[model samples]
Target: MKLLVVEDEKKLLENVAAFLERKGFLVDTAQDAEDGLDLALERNYDCIILDVILPGMGGYEFCRFLREEIGSDVPIIIITALGEIDSRIEGLKIGADDYLPKPFDLRELEARVRALIRRNQLRSEPVIRYGPLTYDSRSGVFSCSKKELSLTSRESSILELFLRNPGTVFSREEITDKIWETGFESRSNIVDVYIRYIRRKLEAAGILDIIQTVPRKGYGLRRLRDDG
Candidate 1:
């Protein structure tokens, strides 16, 4: 999962990002609301952890912009020092899906994040079906003809991305950017390696040639007529 954390406290930001990264999430950080808004608009995140107290634009306004202007339904967890009931209500009214009071446990935050992501997936696209294969993004599980296919973390993430956007060609660069964090070697053949692994798994499940390689372009999911 990918997450954007907007918090001004340097120590808190680093701790949160590090903890979540250890939990297997790709995390991005912004010290102020301005950077947060820019990152939110520029990239796709599974969830956002926004701070109510920001240097400029604040979290409420940012949340409003994300909902009203950008129409992003991504789940947001508003973190604030103001633990009053009215403050929490205001954050919710501005479109935050959840709230975390200041000085809370990191484990609790992780739990909330996981719950929100799971709920969002269930509400959006719980099971993505392409051809005879079914992918449950929430569980990171893939099945074909009721038989489960084992997949590593990278393979599962890649397969989920492909199944979610059938027919959309993803360049190697795009795949790397979405899957790995910053500083990943651009020329690395990791994407190809994972693609080959996924293909082999599918082939073993009696599914053939679903992931089509677009020569010199990228890879895409082919919708087979007999898939239905």
Candidate 2:
């Protein structure tokens, strides 16, 4: 799973990121709320660890913007020194999934992150089907023609996005932001490379003409007759 950690204290940010990375998570850190907002909007993450007192935009406002303005349902955990009941209540009211106070135990934080991600995953459909392709989002399995296709984690993620939004052409930048790790070259033709890989696998399964490329837009799943 991937997580975004937004904290101003350099030591805290580094420690948190390092710990999470060691715990087998793709960790991205932001020094302030503005950069955090940008990363939150750009990439998809399993959870966001936010500090309530940020440089430019405050954590509460950032949470409200993502929940109300942008309609993002990504789980957010507000971490700040303010541990009062009112502050916790306010954070939850603004759509934070959980609140952690400063000086928290790293193990507890890890537990909360795992619990939040587990709850979020439970809310989503475990399996998604499109034409002859079947994907178990939880298991990270992609199958066609009753044959399970071996795919890398990134490849499976890209295919899941396409299956979730069939017929909606996604720009290369959008795909990069959603699928690739942070710092990936947005202009690279790697998106095309992955698309070619997916197409080859599907064709090997005797399924073709599923993924379609738009002239300038990028790629999307072709709507099939079996689509209801």
- Clashes (backbone N, CA, C under 3 Å), per candidate, total 0, 0
For residues 121-164, write the lDDT of model 1, one tens digit per residue: 77798788877899876777899998999998888877877776
Give residue 139's error in model 1 in angstroms: 12
* lDDT (Cα atoms) of all candidates against the true structure: 0.88, 0.87
Worst 10 residues of 1 by lDDT: 177-186
Highest TM-score against the true fold, candidate: 1
TM-score of candidate 1 relative to the true fold: 0.64
lDDT of 2 at 77: 94
lDDT of 1 at 67: 97
